[model samples]
Target: MPDVQIRPVTADDRSAWLPLWKAYLTFYKTELPDAVTDSTWKRFLDSNEPTNAALAWQNGKAVGLVHFIYHRSNWSINVSCYLQDLLVTPEQRGTGMGRKLIEHVYATAKKAGADKVHWLTHETNTTAIQLYERIAERPGFIQFRKPL
Candidate 1:
């Protein structure tokens, strides 16, 4: 209910962004090495990289974080944006912070000439699905993955 500002993550945001990143990984019951986290942070700072990160700020504190990547797609000539990670602090969940973060990515992708923005969530994330369904359409594509 407070004034929220969404902005691209910067080198200075590393400290504020890490906790949200960790919390996000924790929510998914996953863990990554510190080096991987460091590499991801660096990628966001690299202009040449397709990866990017943004944060939702309320009164100078980051309440949420979103990570998106752009890549070539066979379905369209324009690049497609993949929203890889979205995390809102437990206290901030359902407060529209997540929506704001997602919309920010959508706008960013559009400005970059991307044709579509897509993402996946755990099937059990019903609360998040409720919001996502209202904003976007599901194409009923079941993901099949094999981790090497």
Candidate 2:
């Protein structure tokens, strides 16, 4: 609890957000083309897009980031929020920054009339899973995907 402030990313935040974004990708051992990263940043700033992102700031530095999206669900009339990405700087982990970021999304989604918020993480991500389990339930769903 180091006087953290969570807020939606502003245009001026690209500098602060990029390092955290890169760290997040590094954590997952993934890489994306510069074009994809550029597009993702634009989406966050676009009011028309359902994709949204926010950063956790501490002492004027961004220590965490969360990206969420709202989309229609076949099982519910109201939209469902997918908490797509969440990452806290290694030094900030276990300081509750991650939870605060998620709570921010929860409030935002609730205000938007979303039916639920859900996400998936690799099974090996036990640290994140621990935090997630405390705040959300696992419905035991398995994900299947095929890249075209």
Clashes of 2: 0
lDDT of 2 at 110: 99
What is the lDDT of every predicted structure here? 0.95, 0.96
Root-mean-square deviation per candidate = 0.6, 0.6
Question: Per-candidate TM vs. native?
Answer: 0.98, 0.98
Worst 10 residues of 1 by lDDT: 93-102
lDDT of 2 by residue, 45-132 (tens): 9999999999999999999999999999999999999999999999988989999999999999999999999999999999999999
Pairs of colliding residues, candidate 2: none
Q: What is the Cα-based lDDT of residue 22 in candidate 1? A: 91
Show where candidate 1 strays beyond 4 Å. none
Residues 54-89, candidate 1: write the lDDT tens digits. 999999999999999999999899999999999999
